[model samples]
Target: MSLVAEHVSVSIDRADLLADVSFTAAPGRVHSLIGPNGAGKSTLLGVLAGDRAPDAGRVLLRGRRLDEWPLRELARERAVLTQEHGVTFAFRSREIVEMGRHPWARTPAEDDDEREIARAMAVTDVAHLADRPVAHLSGGEKARVALARVLAQRAPVLLLDEPTAALDLRHQEDVLRLARAQAADGDAVVVVLHDLNLAAAYSDEITLLQRGRVAAHGSPAEVLTAERIEDVYGQAVEVIEHPRSGVPLVLPVR
Candidate 1:
């Protein structure tokens, strides 16, 4: 299913967060949102995930209004990984992952839930931490465990807000790889990324936001030009093609 947002706008306490943002995240592809600080990428993500309502426009999932979907049905269709992971509970890592199954509890698929949880943990590399209390783990460890929980949900549409924010280099790449794998399996993946290079390399399409609106949206080669990056980011940057992948690599020019 596709996720589409049109003319979306958000405002809080007279502050405009997102203005007329529009984009489509199609199934079987990865769509990334990227921008400089305070560009409203996170705010826009919240709207897309139905966590926040747009003051002006609407978000649609598979052609239906987002608010129209039943909460339980929506939970089974789209999974979200937000930026914050501040649980202070003493739950084991796998136990936290099992929470994703709440939507499926006592359902017919309940029997396969254990295997799914195990697979999700192994893939996110949190299987070894299965016995560890979530509060006792490091920030990166907690991030990985949070990711495993989202994966265990096995939703067709994923909205991830900085899913790699706390990871090391290897784990960062692993997270993006997992996003790509999910998209390749015909899921719609919408991610908010701070790393322009990672966004260019992994996304089938990128939406660049400036202030509260989209600055550019298209293929990485088209949208991530040096000129656009400099204008939107307020800094001189060099956009070069990657040697192995031919994707745009954003580098600041000092």
Candidate 2:
């Protein structure tokens, strides 16, 4: 099973934002989308999550087109975490996560909703904040709480946009590690990341986009190179092998 982006394109008014872009986020792995600002990472993610309709091509989940999937079935199949997590209420953190169970409401799955919620919170290291008001939390804390909600969703596919943008170093690693663990469990995890090091460390495959088009798509070793980094990011960077892990490590050139 895979979340496929088949020759997707997008245009606003008369300008193109994406053109003939294609991607495949396969099950049982973590795929990362990386690019400079305005590279259409979030736009592509929105299409994959079925929130935006492309002007050309389509997004498919498993083998079914995204537009054709019933809303409830799509919710059950995948969970989307956008850049913004809006909470209008002063609801407790637990309440926010419990909302993830909405798809299972009135169904047999409802019986274990609380258990699922608890497990999700625990995994995201937010269980202790379950009783706290979501609005009172710090940005990092809120990000983790938001992530707990998605974990509670128990969807087979995860599409996250900059999931670690507001986190501390430790928590940043925490989130990526959890993403890896989710992929290890056979879930398809697709994340948009700005930090190339983190993506190199955790992603099984990386898709590099430039000007709304794919520049490279391959294993980290194949896509992330000193030359490619300089060409796409327009900054001098040195790509080196990790001392032990051998994954690519990107460092700014002096």
Candidate 3:
């Protein structure tokens, strides 16, 4: 599976949010979308997930237009996890995770589905909160539960919007490692990340956005240069190679 956004641009309320934005994510690869706030990182993900339409370009899945795919068909193959999760209805953690199956599954109450839900809970380290209400969990805990929901989707393409933003350091690594494993298993994972070091460590390719355009796109070594970081982020960033993983490590200037 692969995703390609071609000359994609989005406009809202007389403002251009994304301009000629484009990138591709192939199977077994993790593509990180990095940018400053309002750079349209989340907007691009929304278009890819079919939640929003591009105003001037097209989203392609393996060269086919995304608009041609049915909603159920698309949902069965792709899953999205957004930044803020507001659970208006008070639902149990288990119930919330089980909702991921609703696209292709008719009976989420089945024993097999329950087992999958439990496995997702365990993987996200939220099994202990399974019986708790989603509204009762802490911010990080709720984020993990929401992650469990998408993981349960078992989709080939995963779109995550700053998935680790609310997580603690340990959980951040845990969740990212899991996403990497999924990509290794032949899934395509596209994540929006603010933490450049984390993006460098897990992403096979980095798509750097600046002012609604693609500033850079390539391997971390090729894209995350100190000069580029300084130009796009408007801050001094020291790019160091990880001692163990040989990936880029970004340090902020004080």
lDDT of each: 0.91, 0.93, 0.91
lDDT of 2 by residue, 77-152 (tens): 9998889876888999999999888988888988989899999999889999999999999998899999999999
Best candidate, lDDT-wise? Answer: 2
lDDT of 1 by residue, 1-254 (tens): 99999999998898888988888999999999999999998898888888898999999998999999999888888999999998877899989999988788778978879998999999999999999999999999999999999989988999999999999999999999999999999999999999988999899999999888999999999999999888888889998889999998889998
Candidate 1 is scored at a TM of 0.98
What is the Cα-based TM-score of model 2?
0.98
| Residue runs of model 3 more than 4 Å from their true location after superposition | 106-112
- Worst ten in a row by lDDT for model 1: 101-110
Model 1 lDDT, full chain set: 0.91
In candidate 3, what are the lDDT values of residues 1-254, reduced to their tens digit?
Answer: 89889899999897989999878889999999999999999999999988899999999986788899988778888999999888999899999999987775664434467677888899899999989999999999999999999988878999999999999999999999988999999999999999999999999999999888999999999999999999998999899989999998999989
**Between the candidate structures 2 and 3, which one is better when assessed by lDDT?**
2
Candidate ordering by lDDT (highest first): 2, 1, 3
lDDT of 2 at 207: 97
| Candidate 3, run of 10 with poorest lDDT | 104-113
- How well does candidate 2 score on lDDT at residue 236? 96
TM-score against truth, every candidate = 0.98, 0.98, 0.96
